[model samples]
Target: MFSRAGSSAFRCCRALPPAVFRVSQPVQYRALSSAAADAAAAAAASPRHPARPTFFRRALSFTGGALLFTSLGLIMVLGPAYESAAAILSSPSDAESLSLFTPPDEDAQAKEDFINSHPLTLSLRSDPDFIESRPHMKIPPSWRKHNLTGGTLMGPGKVAVPPFSWSEKSGKNFVQITHVGTDLCGHMGIIHGGFLATMLDEGLARCCFPVLPFNIGMTAKLEINYKAPAMANQYLVLRATTIKVEGRKAWVEGHIETLPTEEGQEPVVLATASALYISPKQASVSIRR
Candidate 1:
């Protein structure tokens, strides 16, 4: 009867599942119970200490994003402001208009008194016998004359004189002119660029006049290249030539040279220039007369 019962128990144990048999063993059952308890403890602990970002980390992320956005916004707003400010600052100042002043006429008695006091006559046209009686032609009379006899070509504080003369009939159409003295210089001692440009323009115009037939020429374009600084009280001579002529246009080239102040001093090249001259609309105006 005992053997039959043992056989029956073994058959029942063989038919049961592996997991059920494993739990039936004391060592395996204790191990499974301990593992389930550890899992449950871990789940309870996770709920007590929930995952979250720290205050410092959150604050730093927010500040970084805000700074990035503010920088972009500032760039968008300040770019145009900087450009507008630069434009305003770079604009030229307005120039004033000229004023006309009339001088008082002297009577015959006053004229006689003036003539007696000042014996030397300053009239360039009247004194033909005098060596310096001729008008100061900045260029040779043969090349061309602008006829600035009755009109004042310069401001009240300015004075200019022609150094030489040339003839239109002669092939020597090119010439060198100069401007010096403290009155014409700017910035205490340096020659102003504007003044230098003006002189170049005039020289080019004078150069074209002799080349052209009859029409008065006007400056269409002038380009100056400043090679060296022009100093005050130094004689600066600008050499100009008529390079090419096409229809109503004349192309001229010029260069500025500082004359040697003392003996054996080397002449310095100050500036170079090129220009275009166009015939004026009023072609009948006599520049020679």
Candidate 2:
């Protein structure tokens, strides 16, 4: 019975063991994981290229360079034009004839006409005679002046005499000057204020005679009252008179008149002035060449 039981147990055990069992364990995913790691490494090792510059950036650089070049070119080409425009804008209406656009011959003709109309001439050529003839007249010592020996104060076709006079009673210092012009007026036939001032200054300076010895005489005080405008190409007279003297100071008076702006038109009082002349002692130092 024991043997039989043992045999049965063995049989049972064998039978149970004999039951075929397949151990189907999950397959290890090593290959897949290795493939993934390889892909990641490959992605990390690849070099990344930088992006190209945008169109705007390249265009901006080009535009900036072009603008700089263009500005420089314009300045070089148009600088003269700009200056001419400025001059034309600021000049007086009467100055149109003197413009660059005017013909040279026309300008010369206009100038001649103006000069012929306004003639400044005196009968007496002697400065001393002129001064002495005026009774009780006081002349400044600085009046003994001379023209620049060879220098040209008179323009072309103009004549100027040296500051000299020959009269028994007249002093040795005096100057005689003359100028002629025609149509001393603008296109509208008006005498320019600048011309009047210029005439007065010339007359006064001539009356002062020698600008040497006393090279110092500033237009310290000038008061001009314009009584009338001499028509273009009219004879104008400028007479400078020295009324008083105090040390280096002097009082000078002047008048301007038109010969025939209208019939029987007495020479009008165009302008007057009072000047203070520096003394020769004070002016000598500055006058030396």
Candidate 3:
């Protein structure tokens, strides 16, 4: 029985399946770690982008951009304006005469008769202190070509006769009577304000030129106030009074008005102005020793 039992135990042990024993295998952890280290080194050696700009650098860039755009916009806006201004200021051309619409000879004659017979003209002629010479008429021929008022603006229908003027011998006051043609209108039937301003400048300058150092002066400043629209193709009067005079500078005020149709009638005020004139300094001579 013991033998049988021992044999039975042996058979049972043989019949049981073989037990599985787990064997430890070495892992490639070191290799994986080396590959990770190499990747880190490669990443560290690669170049990187720079940091953000400072506040001052950013502000400067913004300012430069703004100025560039602003200059371009100003050029677009001011370029045409400058051209128009230059055209107006330049001397009138021969083609500009068409704008005058010259009147018929008979009508021009009649107009001349009326102005010559005007009471204002007669009175100015009678004044001894006042000389009735045409302003700028006697300028050198070279300058006449470039003169706007005296050269180009003079004609039969236009400034009918040399402007009639009366002046005080003391250089304290001045008067000018002239006819402006219809062609010089800024708006229909209304004379241009710029034309009136030109007249005022000339009249006021004449009023103070005598008091200046060399009897000549340049306009320094002019301020004008328009009170009413001056009608075109009408006789107008410009009167100026000298306010004060210094060594080389003079101040004067003036006004433009219509010539009354009848004696003792009130003339309409068109515009008024005040101006400062400054005479150029005398040239200095240098003596070379």
Runs with alpha carbons beyond 4 Å of true place in candidate 3: 1-104, 282-289
lDDT of 3 by residue, 149-197 (tens): 8767766645655565666778898998888888787899888888899
Best by lDDT: 3
Q: After superposition, how far is residue 72 of candidate 3 from its true place, in Å?
A: 48
Q: Of 1 and 2, which scores higher on lDDT?
A: 1
lDDT of 2 by residue, 1-289 (tens): 5698899998887786433443222223666778899999999999988898899998999999999999999999898667655553453331222222221355445543543343322334322244322110112112212232212322222222111111222222332222333433443566666667766765565455433235235555667787766554344556666666555666577666654445466656666665555555645654442
For each candidate, give its TM-score against the true structure: 0.43, 0.39, 0.59
Of candidates 2 and 1, the better by TM-score: 1
Q: Could you report the Cα RMSD, in angstroms, for every candidate shown?
A: 20.0, 17.9, 14.0
Candidate 1 C-alpha error for residue 280, in Å = 2.4
Clash statistics: count for each candidate: 8, 18, 0
Best by TM-score: 3
* Candidate 2 structure lDDT: 0.48
**In candidate 2, how many Å is residue 209 off?**
3.7
